[model samples]
Target: MERIIGLIDMDCFYAQVEQRDKPELWGKPVIVVQHSRRGVQGGILAVSYEARGFGVKRGMTVAEAKQLCPDLATCLVPIGEYADKADIQKYRNASAEVFDVLNNFDSNIVVEKASVDEAFLDLSIYVDNIIEKFKEGVDLILPEFLPSSHIADGHDKNENDDERISRISTFLESSQNDISLLRLAIAALTIEQIRKQIRDKTQFFCSAGIANNKMMAKLVCARHKPRQQTIVPFKYVREILKTTPIRDVRGFGGKMGQKIQERLNIMTMGEILSIDFNKVVESFPDEHEWLLSVAEGYDSEPVKARSESSSIAVSKNFPGRNAINMVQELRQWLDGLTKELAKRLVTDQLQNKRTAENLVFALATEDGRPQKTLKLVSYHPDILIDMLWKAIKPLNKASDEQTWHPKIYNLYLGATKFVPGIPTANRDITEWLNSKGKKSSDEPLTDEIVFVHEEKKVYCPQPSTSRSDSVIVLDDDDDDEKEVPITEDDEEYIEVDGKRFSKTVFKNLPVMLRKQYEHKIALETARKLKMNAKSSRKRGNSLVAAEQSHMKKHKPLTSFFRKK
Candidate 1:
């Protein structure tokens, strides 16, 4: 099906809303602006059609607008005041009424609110259902063009004045079935129905367009006056766009459209469409697909409502060079932004539990050059702040004696990684330590273990000739149970039949001495296991007696005969 997209633009929305509340401003040039110095001069937020005729435009200062039309009437925009709770509720209520009316046509209709005033509606399905209603046959009749000499204003007439009037009368009398007239009548009736419904329900006036695509529809909608609609047939798409400037197309704005004009030397949409698609793509790499689609008069992209997960970012423009104070200012700004983001996350029921994958820091140069640096940060806010500070410290502390100190104008921060918070089996030890009064540098082992095992063992590795070198005999074993002299390197010792031996030689000792050494090792291992498993009601597998007995059975008598 040929897509029928409608761009419904409210004519001077703010101005109309103001005028509707205050009926005295009807049919007069009204401009909404901000009160400032130089006798109320700021961007023109909205301008009535009457004001637009007198060279008024949005973003034009009130002073400049007045210079263009000296008698222009002005009013301050109430958005800042009306953006409050009560007023926003009213605005939303009005918007809901508008949507409710549009929804009656088709539940499948896509409605996108471009702003308070403008919206794009995908009416392809709705149009398809009503196609039969507009299929009636009609004849085309062109209006007769009168010559200059035959027309007169207040001045005296020429000899052809009566002939011109007679021709116009005859043409009007002969043709009662002009196709343009019939089409316009149908369009007017349809638009009037919508307009009446909106005004009665919401007290707002909206202008609509009817065409096969968005671009032509938007253009036609703007062509007509307030509270009116215009229909562009599918056959007239080529002709209508032939002379339309490239900048006039929706989505073509500012530097993008200007670049296209400069590079392609094409002033109108028709000229752009006539060029090779590949050349257009090469010229505008960033918007190649969009330019090509517009040129072909085909757009399939659907309008969708905004989603929260799409983006969450914060940015600021600084005043001067990278001075010492700049770092403090940046930190302050980041704190404010983080606080706001945290509030929003809570409101949306989202968690910030995982580390952010991308942390971008954009730097705007004095000479219009763009440079940026990026780093990764942990999910914890404190850790993220520390990471950002470390990354920016070098730039913030650059010496004045070096190259030019480039003023930092812009900074941006964002988080790309998101993880849902779910309960897990393993708890993060570092996180738990940080939560308590303990520092991350604290040792994992107990103080007693460190002092007894580590400190005593280091001093036990010294030679002492005064100590006895005799080997002791064991009671349970024969001559094989003889004890070996303790060496300076051996710290552990075991007794066998009144004989002492180092654990290093316990394997060579008699059976009685080996069994005695094994028992000591088993006791020490079990003690450690009990400490670790204190919180568990069920005994840990590591504390099983079977495992301890296996180790005890392999100890050697000669190895256990050494002494410390």
Candidate 2:
């Protein structure tokens, strides 16, 4: 079955959310700016269509935008001591509402949120069901059912206008015989319904594109503006590509796209489709299959209904003279960022049922941007700060001498990738436990093992006895147990049999093993006390013997008053 996919792009997402919340702000020029600590002139993150008419664009400073549009209304993203990075949780919440509306469209539909303001939906199941209904006693859907949308025919003039109903009638009449076109028609109809529900429920407008695959769906989505849907029939794919720039395609918007342009000596996607892409793209053999598929107007990649994001990051940019040259300023930013990041991780865990497997901290200077990745077992705020601070110390240090450390202009803290489940009861760990014939910590550990809540790493001093249990399970024979993630906090350590275990990781150990370590520590302390007392007694006897020997020598000097 041909897949019917739709891409939904929210119109001026952050700006739209602001205008929607304040009914008075409608029809006015508005832009959302990230708050700057220096003043009200932060960088613009979103620009409304009204603002764009006045030559305002995103990435311009608030002052610049206001200069362009005298009547512009500006709103700042949430900012505070903790959110020195400018928090966009409000927009994030708004996004959830939008996706919630989209998800409720049909039980068979699959929604893949592509970004904060974009999502790809697999509408094949819904379209197939609608097609089956047409085969039923029900007559074909009426043209009135087809709402306003673009056809994406590569025409200089838009044929889709107020007379969209007429166009829809003609299109439907033509598609009655061709099943492929009929599938697209049904998908368009479904999108129209979804868009109507979204606007009615959320008061937020979005544009959608319907096609046979993800690439076409995304390409056609931008053909129309807010509150509209576009459809690209299978027959029109070639004409659409004829005008589309290869860079405009999703994956080719960056460095890879530049290489393709130089190597293939082509700028347009259609030109490549006409050429022998296989013979020309020999250097990029890895991309051969994808490029060939694109040449044929096909993208077999499925719409991934991913619940957890690959990475969740927050960053703040310090432009121009606001760059941080002092170590203290960088430390402040790092402290704030780590605190904010910890909160984000908690939110992600509750929402996605997953936590980050690694923490990525990045620093951007004019010269270069450096990033550090460390294992993250615990999201404790203190641990995050300490680990990140230690990582940056080797790179930068403020001094009287012109230091090699570049002034930091941007700061970022984010999770690299998420672990599948919450740390409490991870499915992967459970599977591993079962394979080892060991019950989960929640269950008995052969001798009354207990599960503990989130705990910090606890380190014992290097064991004096070779008989102590190692960091792994005390008696487990598996020499190759997978290492669980642990915080890189240097302050916490517990050495058992010369092996190191993080405090947080050790806390997760079976209660039985933890008790053994505690008992051993007490025994070692008592033994140390006994050994010290014995040594002190020996020193006292040696001192008495030395004194008696000195008296026997009889060579002691007398005081000045009683010289002898």
Best by lDDT: 2
TM-score attained by model 2: 0.71
Model 2: lowest-lDDT 10 consecutive positions: 555-564
Instruction: Give Cα-based local distance difference scores for all models.
Output: 0.49, 0.68
Alpha carbon lDDT of residue 92, candidate 1? 31
User: Tens digit of lDDT per residue, candidate 1, span 1-564?
Assistant: 456566667767777766775788888888977533224355676798889899899888778889988888887643221111011222333454466565553455566665556667765554333334434532322222211111111121223446545543443333345433233323333444555566765567778776666676676676544665555555455666667788887766677788888988898866777878789878987887777667655556676642124344555445444321444555665555443332232222212222234555555556453434454433334555666666655664336433323555655666554444311221111332123325344533110000001211111111111122222332332423344454454556665333345654444332322433354456456656664564254464444553464445333212222221
Q: Using TM-score as the measure, which candidate wins?
A: 2
lDDT of 2 by residue, 151-255 (tens): 766762366455566666767777767788777877777777677767765678899989989999998898877677888888778887877888998788999
Tell me the spans in candidate 2 whose CA falls farther than 4 Å from its real position.
Answer: 160-163, 276-279, 282-289, 319-321, 365-369, 397-404, 424-564
Full-model lDDT, candidate 1: 0.49
